[model samples]
Target: MNNSFGLTHIVQFFLFVALQVLLMDNLVLYSTGFCFIYVAFLLYLPLTINRVWLLILGFIVGFTVDIFYDTMGIHAAASVLLAFLRPHVLNLLTPRDGYDSSDAVNIHVMGTRWFLTYAFTLILFHHTAVFFLETINSQTFLYTLVKVLISTLFTGIVVIIMQLLFFSPKRERIDYR
Candidate 1:
């Protein structure tokens, strides 16, 4: 990626993180309800991005969120896992011949069902990992599960909204090399 693109990604990541931590973190519906807009960063990555860079970006984004929430390394670990699994998930959802040259993943292009399934699966994985690690030694299995479900759903909804609102399709360019 060029310096401008890298800088833009960094800026977007920070903006999402700030919105998640500063705004959505405190905007709870029920006692256990909380939205996570930061996941949008992971969900919106280009399909053709390098896996290594994706993982690194995930870790950095999650760790940054952790710093704000004081959750230690839980978010970092989960985000890396989500990043690592993204390509596999995308591959499973999209056929080999259906890869879009633009690398943008959205309902308009990937189909609503496919896109929702993709988003839900990754969000679930991330929430599962995070909640499991957070409650490793605790005896509150049911409580943790509830929190995970609610938070995951809330986060997923926010991600979908932000994606639909702020995301745009990337233009496809031919490489004649």
Candidate 2:
């Protein structure tokens, strides 16, 4: 974030937003699970990205979705919360050897356990904010929590599958004389 946001991220932003608003928006399961796959864009940003930039990017991602979904900034609020809390979660889950500043948070680099844990934790919080803020009522608290959990699980699984299918792990090339 010290430099300008790169072309790669700009393209990815559009792709994620389009994918979410166009496809994932309607991909609800049993009306209890929603797939907010757009968060993968924010979650995959470089480890050392500036916190302020992260928040701005998060809001932009969510606001773009809001424009399509016609929801008044609820996604923006939840995304801001995700960006705000991401660093703390990363710190808590940091590997003993630590992360390379340039590393992206993905299953390809972080390994499955780490990625799953990180994805689920953030997605749980993100979905909770999205669903609960969308409807704040004691009458439906239990149902909302169920939705949050289901959506979190669903989103996390899809995010991981995305990385696995789309991103190739780096392979060491052996040169023989």
Note each model's CA RMSD in angstroms: 2.7, 4.4
My TM-score estimates for the predictions, one after another, are: 0.88, 0.91
Model 1 alpha-carbon drift over 4 Å, by segment: 168-177
Candidate 2 CA-lDDT value: 0.86
How would you encode candidate 1's per-residue C-alpha lDDT over 39-141 as one tens digit per residue?
7788877788889999999999999999999999998999999999999998898776778565466656676787889998999889889888988957888
The total of clashing pairs for model 2 equals 0
For each candidate in the order shown, give its overall lDDT on alpha carbons. 0.81, 0.86
The lDDT of model 1 is 0.81
lDDT of 2 by residue, 61-170 (tens): 98988899888999999999999999999999999998875566768778889888888999988999999899989899999999999999899889988888877777
Residue runs of model 2 more than 4 Å from their true location after superposition: 1-5, 171-177
TM-score of 2: 0.91
Per-residue lDDT value at 127 in model 1: 88
